[model samples]
Target: MQTAQTVMMVRPAAFRANPETMKSNHFQKSWDGDLDVASLARKAFDDYAASLRAEGVEVRIIDDISSQETPDSLFPNNWIVMLADGSIFTFPMEAHNRRRERRMDIIADLSHDYEVLRRVDLSRYEDKNLYLEGTGSLILDHDNRIAYACRSSRSSEVVGREFERLSGYRIHWFDARDRLHHPIYHTNVMMSIGTRFAIVCLESLSSESERRELISQLERTGKNLIDVTFAQMEAFSCNVLELRN
Candidate 1:
């Protein structure tokens, strides 16, 4: 029933400033070696917006808070999720660079029209070395009240479990691996679930039991499967969101 009429995406200001992943984290950037980040990001911004528009979705394009120099602002799901009930969640991110992306000004701008409810600020957990990077760490099955997550430093089992308890979502979990044979950092970068369909790269799941569970859950929920290869996943195929459509 979510016809996702309006969606938002941030134009990447510092395309190559994702220093957390490049410097601190284990995740590798595919185009880091020889890519003109600003140029590539601009094209990607256009293309991403076009793709969403092609689906008849209205896009709310916001240039990232460049003055703040917040990298990874291109992926906005971390900082906010405007809910059907008009509530907004301000999530906590594990990466220090990402944590800086949250700004009250953006939230305040959004509150002009939407009914503002409680702000669930989870940043306190970060002080304890616990974190949950919003939709990046948890792909919400909003209709079913489920949150599918892969345990990582960004998405701790403890945190995901607590979210299940708080949000009343059943946790569909798995331990997945990337090409380098390391666990993928964020869950949303690997798989996405929707009401009518599911787009996933089953090959990324190295364990048979884990893969089976992920597939079975989708199938049981009556979803049409669109399986992609790990190559496609690397292309951000898993990053595709089935908006309110």
Candidate 2:
């Protein structure tokens, strides 16, 4: 089967225009420009999502509840993935604010179209003091049975392996770090996989061995590598959604 034509985008509760996210070299910053951050964020969110819809995607737009003070609420994929098979896996987030982002009502809302095949609840990991943000942790090549992940508080071996066990994917695990030697919080920040290609910043992987491993996984899966520099990755360039067309 092919990928879904649906693209899900959460409206930005904390909308603002930030230059930092436009390029990868710097830490993506919060909006401090003349425009009201919230307003700009809302416009950007709408425009990007509208662009996707224009491409014939079946987009589901959910309004963000801003009063709750959830800054990163716009990135919905961190919380859920509505599989074509109808299974919904709600992720356990490392950040407290994100926990509110998942509402069963949202899943219930989606049940009308998608079949709920499986529910893999890892939120208990939060009590155990571990985490793994859904697609943020794992870049899955759905058709190829491959999953690429970088270990972080939101991406742990225990949870990642558990997902593999349920999804039956081959895991290619590695440590990804930034220029300062700190681990990248999300694998999606450094790379993304499309049906035919990948956009990645290979240098972000601290170890030569891990870099090799990442490249090997991509190559073995027959993905055309569209390599980006660490400069590009930080721009959230790797945080892409390959929607159903």
What is the TM-score of candidate 1?
A: 0.87
Model 2: residues >4 Å from true position, as ranges?
15-26, 31-34
Q: Please provide, for model 2 over 122-207, each residue's C-alpha lDDT reduced to its tens digit, 9 standing for 90 to 100.
A: 78788876787888888878888787888766688987777777778777888888888777878888888888898888888778
Error of 2 at 187 (Å): 0.3
List the candidates' TM-scores in order. 0.87, 0.89
lDDT of 1 by residue, 1-245 (tens): 42367888888887675656653245555464776877787898899889888978888877776777776888888767766655577776777778878878778778875688756666777788897778888877777767788877777777666666655668888987777777788887788876688888788889999999888888887878889887898888888766643
Model 1: how far is 200 from its true place, Å?
A: 1.7
Ten-residue segment with the worst summed lDDT in candidate 2?
Answer: 17-26
Alpha carbon lDDT of residue 178, candidate 2? 85
